[model samples]
Target: MELHDRRQAPWHDDSFEGEMVAVMTVGVPGGEVLLETSRLLLRPWRVDEAVVQRELWTERDPRVPPHRRIDEDGHPTVAELEDSIRTHKVWSTGLLAVERKASRDVIGYCGLVDSGRGATGEPELAFELLRRVWRQGYATEASLAVVGWARSSGYERLWATVWDWNTASRRVLAKVGFIETDRKEVDAVHGTTLFTTRPL
Candidate 1:
């Protein structure tokens, strides 16, 4: 499992969604990469999953990166999350509800954001999982699939911005193959931090 140099990474001609992705077991080759890993399924987001959507607001203290959390109110309303989903419909993003199949729970979301492309213009990757699901590899798994989608879907890179102090999100971004692509100080409506990314 030695990592390949990004400089020499092979560029596949196949466009995402045009062909069936190859999903393979670790150490196996030539399988379509749908990225349906154990305990998680990477898919699209829906507005109906709002209660879980409120995880964006509810799980903030001590965990959520500054950029990910909502306002000073410290509580994200399901109405706000639902409005977010409805707004995204006007422009498509890979925003998906991360549901735990065993419990049929809509725990939270992970996906691409149309804006915040960083200096490199890589579509930014974003996620806000319920506090209950932290440390379970769900964020990493979902982010991996998102990175895969970005690669296969004609995108040369992906980005994620985080408060440098948010160690958990920093860990998730690192686990998903995004490197520190860029940084800049912006007036923090809330907290002052920025972490951007490019292709791995």
Candidate 2:
């Protein structure tokens, strides 16, 4: 797929009054999420990535847990993932592509997922990354960016659901200011999931 990486401040040295007004009104307030930290870029999920299924799905890396791996071999099949992405559940909300800037390779994702409604049933946050990119502080960086996004966009809080055994994620959540608030196991999914929350 042709990756468009220039989603950021379009204004440079060249400026026209008409364009400048447009930039100030929309571009400045609507900051593009091309978040970078010298290593990775936390960008939106792109469509057209079927060939990456095996690598993203089946790999037994520490970065992702067993349940979330949609593929048996590596990554989700292009067809399956595209289907997921097309669904409003996956496409409208939830998910991102964690890319290594130097290589433009999508190692994995660190993003938020909508967990239905809160007491009033608000949105939720879920995140993950490939094992190859784990423990290098990329998760924290991307998550912080997500938090900023949630706050800037008027989200009140961000929540996370994680397996009890995933101490690594627990730590990352704490690092990003999430505290263990509640726990519930989705019988439909059949695994004990801890629900943690933090104000945006």
For all predicted structures, in order, the TM-scores are 0.67, 0.67
Task: Name the regions of candidate 2 deviating beyond 4 angstroms.
Answer: 1-38, 60-76, 86-93, 186-191
- Backbone clash pairs for candidate 1 read 21-32, 21-33, 22-31, 22-32, 22-33, 23-31, 23-32, 23-33, 45-96
Off by over 4 Å in 1: 1-35, 62-76, 90-92, 119-121, 186-191
What tens digits encode model 1's per-residue C-alpha lDDT throughout 88-154?
5411235656666677676777766656445444567888788777898778776765666556555
- Tell me the whole-model lDDT of each prediction, alpha carbons only: 0.58, 0.57
Name the lDDT of candidate 1.
Answer: 0.58
Model 2 alpha-carbon miss at residue 180, Å: 0.4
